[model samples]
Target: MDGNRVATLVGFAATLVVLAGLVWVVGIDDTLAALTTADPVALAAVAGIALCWLVSWGLALWTVLRALGSPVSPHIAILVFVAAVFSNNVTPFGQAGGEPLSALLISTAADTEYETGLAAIASVDTVHFLPSVGYAIVGFTFVAAGAVQLTRNLAFAAAAVAVLALGIPVAAVLGWQHRYRIEAAVIRGFTPVVTTVARVVPRWSPPSAASIEARIERFFAAIDRIATDRRTVIQTFGLSAFGWACLAASLWTSLYAVGAPVPAEVVLLVVPVGSIASVVPLPGGSGAIETVLVTLLVSTAPVSAPVATSAVLIHRVGSYLLPTLVGGGVATALGVDHAASPET
Candidate 1:
């Protein structure tokens, strides 16, 4: 096997091992019992929240794509967005793989240039980051009010919030101010990866570095055109904010289903913190997020270990399993899973 294949297999194995350890730690019997004992009404409520989340994200993607002049149907929007979610969570390189795969899927579906699709995807991501400032502020206010405790997990969460609060804005400013330089750097960074993907994936033509750079320049030009419009900016960010709110609400509903209800403030504070763990390379960030959630519950909330484990697992079912299953099915239907060959 080549190095990339070996590395991919190793990463997959490591993810499985971590997940197996998580199951063991949570206790298979206890976890199963907890799941079985959840309130049917609460589960339904959580499912509703998940459904809303799906719609909100779909709308956000649709808004960006339309603004970029590559509009897709709502049905296509949901499928591509969910498939991207599954890709990001399950694949190595975290969001790196997800965004490219999402753009590829969009290009395939909409008959648009890959560059145009990537620009639209980038717009969605940019809008999404704009809301982290608000989330961090709300979380910080709760911490200051002492409604949310400064437990180790919360501390980790707070640090993550700080990073998001600072990093994203600065990056945006820099990218905006130095669009051409940044675009060049971005193309430089992505070229090797995209080149590798082109080699491995059918229907892709490997391009010279100069051609890759030209494509990236076109991507940024497309993004800049969309970003310059005030209405597009407002609508995209508005939908993105609502999408994040749904994620927090989904977490709150999951906690309620296990009868370990916390205030909405607490949910907002911890959900983002736990979610930052998803950026880690582990599949679905299973081990890190479960640890973070368990710690957050035990130290910050009134829940016992058993209840915390159950609530987190329930949340994972809605947030991770349901979307992944649906997205995987969509990927199969779209022929995304079969797009690549073993040999470049």
Candidate 2:
């Protein structure tokens, strides 16, 4: 079986485990009652909007690929994006765990080099960050103006968003300024492995130190290709923001479905913070994401504990679980094999 296909199985099983855990933690009877009593149309809309979120982000990826000279169709871009989501969902630490595999799939599906694919996803992530903070800032502004209120958990969530909005940009700028030093450190770290491989496999010609350097250069070159294009950057950003909107809307709809309507700003605030909590080193950030979302909703919004839990569960079914299943199907249909040689 393909590595990704196997990951799909793992992802499916993990989602079940997470779902079961959620039911147990939140009380199965309450969860069942919430689901049974919820508005079917709004719950359906949650899943549909989640699909829209995927498509929007796929468009963003397509834009980046076209800028990087891939020129794949939007359909293929969505396939790659979904497969990438599967990779992320099945692994620990979310995107960080899945990126290398996702990069491989992107290169394979898009007919681009590995470094270019790597750069595409990395660039997408960098671009995606700002929009998240932008949404959070808008919500935080409402909080400041007395339009919205916060509990202890939500206050902390807002404070964290404030730091992320300020911190990420500064970190990015500093990292870019010192990129050469960082590159040198990376090269130095890899030198011993290259030497050992060369020593172990004398019959085969291993990649030279220059080849590694060139690969790094190409990675940056791909990022530069996208960055240098103002139009492409704008399109990517626009698509990303649209995707974020779809996600927030999905959550808001979920809350509404459960008859726990909250202010729109509450969704704006909670969605981004929930996303941030997704890096908690759990597969697809399963446990942590739900916890953060439920806490934030119950704290900052006019929702009961059980209703808040149900709403988050419903929202995640679309955002996390649905994507995992769909992406897995995509990986299987596409026959993506990350272990295969690029030339094959």
The TM-score leader among the candidates is: 2
* Candidate 1 local distance difference test against the native: 0.75
In candidate 2, list every pair of residues with a backbone clash: none
Candidate 2, residues 118-235, lDDT tens digits: the string is 9999899788888999899888777556635445785687688977798778988898888878888888889778788888886866676778888988998898888899998999
In terms of lDDT, model 2 sits at 0.84
Instruction: Quote each prediction's TM-score.
Output: 0.84, 0.89
How many clashes (backbone N, Cα, C below 3 Å) per candidate? 0, 0
Provide the clash count, candidate 2: 0
Question: Per-residue CA lDDT of candidate 1, range 1-344, in tens?
Answer: 38855766677788768766776776777766776778888888777777777777777788777877888898788788887777666666566657877777777666679998788777887777768668856965776477444556666666778888887678778868887787678778887888899988999887777887788778878888888978888987888888778777777777787767887776676776776676677766666777777776666667777677888877777787788788877766666543652433
- Against the reference, the lDDT scores of all candidates come to 0.75, 0.84
Per-residue error at 208 for model 1, in Å?
Answer: 3.3
Please give the range of 10 consecutive residues that has the lowest summed lDDT in model 1: 335-344
Point out where model 2 deviates above 4 Å.
1-26, 147-150, 197-205, 336-344
- Error (Å) of candidate 2 at residue 257 is 1.2
Q: What TM-score would you give candidate 2 relative to the actual structure?
A: 0.89
